[model samples]
Target chain A: MKTEKTLVTITEEMVLNYEVIFGKQNKLPPTFPMIFYRYINVPWDYKTAPIHRKQTCVCHSELSIGESYHCVVTLDQVKQKGKYMFYTQSLVGYNLEGSECFRCVSELVVH
Target chain B: MCVRISRTLTITEEKIKQYAFLSGDFNQIHLDQKEAERYKFKEPIAHGMLTMGLTLEIASSFTEKGMRISTYEMQFIKPIFQNDLIYIVAKKKKQDYGSIYLEITGRKQNELVVRGELALERLSSIHFNNATKESGM
Candidate 1:
């Protein structure tokens, strides 16, 4: 059987799921390059906001030293006003030799 | 090629409900079976992120200080239903600058459900300090 891939879409439900599974103690990582969001709580209603359609590119191959692959995430724009919005957020990948790569999600907002 | 990483994790409505309650996700696609029927699957399915995060636990199994994923990507090609036992697998791909690349797969009943690549960076004082400084610390 062929291996299937999962596209990571940011919705209100996703935030809710993360909260339910990881709990507040395991909050989602903050927007990269900015730690200010670390203190901001992930509101349960975050799922109720509008989000960009995200395209996830998950590679399933191993890499050697000095090798790198890009995980490009495309963020769609929101049309509704004051309904909240999400953007295509980028994260730096890891360097562990054998562990799985990072599983980071995009950003959601009330914009 | 396909590999097995974990025991079959049975997907259940009750489990889905708890995830919904915790994630605050009210998407009809995951909660209302009738609503999901309108979709191709014709039933509620597990949240993609939920499945993604669950793999992190599997990553923890291989390390002690904990695994830090730096990059990850996946495509949702199949619908995974509740009560379905999913066999999970994660493999080491490569390493750069204390970061590791991983190939992850999730399958149910010997069928592939999801696959993706993940990159994990270790939390190091030198790396962290350099990263923070590069960001204008």
Candidate 2:
């Protein structure tokens, strides 16, 4: 079977669901969703927000917050099989006050 | 393909929950040990991003000061269970025009868990300049 990729945006409702799942310990950090377009030609549809200075966290430094601006990107991934499959192809955060380049982190999960 | 550094870490259920708290990824396969077993995993596995973050941390340590990662790509080969002692190894693969390329691998004992690449560039040359220019610095 051919794999399919789709971009998903975490809406407010999804965040609320996460809160429901996490219950009392529901301190979910905001993250910008992005895709590594390897061999696809798809137009960027997600609206880009105005860059504003704010404190943000990235990857392993999740506890030590730093200054940054939010950038949202749409992600496309191969359709996963089974109930427990999730692939976080990349995780990135850009420094608002320091640099235009963003820090990228990547990983995958299959069940 | 030289210059390699490795760091060891133990993945715990609490740490996995912490990652889920940060990333908003509360997948039961990663949070519930019983559910994970039903799904065929021995136990709740750690979030892939958590492992990726550690890999990036190791990669960042080898680069020059002021260098920032621009691109990171990885592939997950196996599930990482709780308390698994993971060894993250990063090797400098190539460099050109201030861009350093690195190969990263995560292994549990002799078993490969994840593999990927990273691209690093000087912060001052790339986004830093633009940020400064925008700030009229």
Candidate 3:
């Protein structure tokens, strides 16, 4: 396989694709009647070990029912892509309510 | 306070399939038991992300009125096999009107197989008002 990089946007189709993967869309209480967004970039045909590097930024539209929140997550490989494959995911807590967004970011390398 | 709950779940092949569909993670280890056994795990295991997603479901059940998860972190500990009766648990260890800390765990036959913690900010109604005032949401 050749090395490839794909940037996938969170759209209705992508959400449907994820729903297909999980089987039951209702099992997860998605903030429906609203839109959920994410950006996924994957590097294929990795030269080193088959390690996947991902970054997820999640945001939801305002809903009439409950409170709305925005959160961001950044995950990086801890190891130098050799010996061991280590990955660490950092979460940023943001309420996105009242212009107040909680934010935090962490990095990890797997060997 | 920690938001927590527990339930015994039948990890059926169909359930796994659904999870695979939702995550876009159709790895063979989760779909093929025979191929899974060939690997070091010796049995088909669920996707780590899927397991985490399930754990999130369990935690969401305990959310108090008007509260939503703002952030969380999970680490994959062990593989959950198909048809295994696994116990899933989540607890709220700390909380406030603004933020909450949650601890979640998963077990098979009473043995610890997975564990993680989450930090969720309480989604307040005040923000939606501002979003509406600013963006007409």
Candidate 4:
């Protein structure tokens, strides 16, 4: 008789890939998934079933994935400069370790 | 030496949707109002990266010709919702060697939303000039 065990290691790489595929297609904001995964302990590659299922919006109670839901990547830079800058400020600060996970995900996804 | 600056921003549904497309995050808490309410959020919230990235941008604006951000650490204290008017406050905290340190905070009215620290590296002005020249900016 042979015994086999399964070991699961979830990395930023896996999350990045998941976002690249299913994430890009939906109208979900970036922060939602980041926070969602932060608290959930399930492997992104769990073989049981699709990790994400289509769900209705709680606000309007709509389940449609319409063209309006699609985001325009080209507009991101504009959005950042215009709307984002309006609310934030620029400064200099000491280095810290809180953003390590963010850096890993950024390097894996953006670069 | 804390040098601080502040600005105001209004989170919009369009911006949230745009971030969703760029980052591939469609969590209902940000898209569906009901979902957000169910999750105990006042409304659909802005992405944390959106706030963080904007903070970095603010830092970059204060940098000299060749200076660049080298590292940062942030903690989210509150959720930022669409249509909420928020303020971003950045402060220059310290300077040592060739690095400049900063502290950033985001506030909605009187509520604290996000806060963090960052470090910027000072590069040779020549490098900055050369890069700008090469890019033709």
Candidate 5:
């Protein structure tokens, strides 16, 4: 199991940029977790790279701008199905109080 | 108990590129035509989250009064090729206490591409507005 962590902050500019393209909303978009992907830092083969197949996000608290989050991504499990490797990873965010603000579990299929 | 809204969206390469840079996925399957052709897809695919983000925007519109998302789950049933138009729909499931449930669906060319469920927590209008106003939203 590989675990990686990074501090993520949602700046006003990011929200503005997203809103410009996706439209403005009262709350940060659920896709806000995407900011954590750069920290994935994992290497893979493009010819047989993992493709996103499923996602689940549970929000425990509302995300406010300027909130610093400790984001963590971990490889939870892997299964080989014929010619594909189904990998499941858990992504979570914690607020200053160390309380879970959100969790997103992503399943990727690699050929 | 039942409500529905639908819209047609055309996702462009420029849109996918923006998401790629923001998310930092850079899987090549989502960018780089030559690299993407190396795979079985033979064409670039949009990020799954990009679609999810759009879905959320739709839900947010429905809850502008005071509701906020609580839980969202999505299944990528099929690959959505870039520059293709996708039809999205959101239907109200039910409401319990201070929460409203919704079922979301996305399709490309009449083929189901993604399906998901969304739950929104009902908050006081003033409360929700106050939270967002802090950011000058």
Candidate 6:
């Protein structure tokens, strides 16, 4: 399943809070986009949220404060093995120009 | 890969809760002991993303203008329980054409808990790909 596009904006407050929590690193943390994961995760029907087992994030270009991005989340695969269910999902963000700015692939597990 | 640095920190409940609030990951498994038991974990476990964020802290020390990461990948090999002293090591793997690669590993004492790698470049330019400054990157 794929989610409808969601617009995410990087605000000054967000950048400030992030820098305060993580560090004053001039570059945006790659995992910063994971903050919006919950928006697209609304489509899942699980009674409890799945465990985030692993993650892979890639940044294709620089993202600045005040920039807005369009994100789409896709449930890439699901497998059931006896008492366990494994889910793979990808959340991709694109700049207004439609260039892929960043992407995150998450592996989740539910029992 | 030969050059390396290491740091350690004890994961605290306060830190975990702080991250959950910031990230909007209100998973019970990360907050309640009972919920963690359901997953066969002892006590509550730190969110993988929280550790992932902390992992990048070590990587940031290697940066001058900060990091424009090409990739930040991590695997939660084992549950990181609160109070576990996490030892993190980062190695400079290689660099070429403005991009640098680093390998990182996290251990809870003697056992490996997380392993990852980062590909980074200086964050000085918004146009990341250009052969020259005047090419309109």
Best of the candidates, DockQ: 6
Report, for every candidate in turn, its global Cα lDDT versus the true structure: 0.49, 0.52, 0.49, 0.46, 0.79, 0.82
lDDT of 6 by residue, A1-111 (tens): 988899999888777776766767567777898887655545766645588778999887776788889999989999988988899998899999887889999999887
Highest-lDDT candidate: 6
For model 5 the local lDDT of residue B18 reads 86
lDDT (10s digit) by residue, model 4, range A1-111: 111211223345544544443333122222222322332232222111111111111111111122112111111111123312211111111112211111112211110
Residues B24-124, model 2: lDDT tens digits? 55568788878787767788877666666545557545343656555566666787898899898888889887678778888888998878777666645
Across B1-137, the per-residue lDDT of candidate 4 in tens digits comes to: 55787777776787777666655566667788887777566777776665564445456454534455545566667777787887888888888766677787888878887777776665453356446766997
Q: Candidate 6: where are CA atoms >4 Å away?
A: B123-137
The worst-scoring run of ten residues by lDDT in candidate 4 chain A lies at A53-62
Q: In angstroms, give how far residue B135 of model 6 lies from its true place.
A: 11
B1-137 in candidate 6: lDDT tens per residue? 36798989777888788878878888988899998898788889998988898778777665655657778999889999988899999888888777788889999868999999898876554354633444754
Q: What is the TM-score of chain B in candidate 2?
A: 0.86
Better of 1 and 2 by TM-score: 2
Candidate ranking under DockQ, highest first, comes to 6, 5, 3, 1, 2, 4
Looking at model 4 chain B, which ten-residue stretch has the lowest summed lDDT?
Answer: B121-130
What proportion of the true contacts does each candidate reproduce?
A: 0.12, 0.00, 0.06, 0.01, 0.70, 0.69
Q: Compare candidates 1 and 4 on TM-score and give the better one.
A: 1
User: Residue A76 of model 2: what lDDT?
Assistant: 31
> What tens-digit string does per-residue lDDT give for candidate 1 at A1-111?
111222222345445545465443232332111211122233233344322232242222222234332322223333344744444443323333433233234433433
Runs in model 1 deviating more than 4 A are A1-111, B1-7, B125-129, B132-137
- Flag the better candidate by TM-score, 3 or 4: 3
Candidate 1 interface RMSD, angstroms, 1 decimal: 8.2
Say which docking band candidate 4 falls in.
incorrect
**Candidate 6, which CAPRI tier?**
medium
TM-score of chain A of each: 0.25, 0.27, 0.34, 0.20, 0.86, 0.90
Q: Interface root mean square deviation for model 3, in Å?
A: 6.1
- Ranking 3 against 4 by DockQ, winner: 3
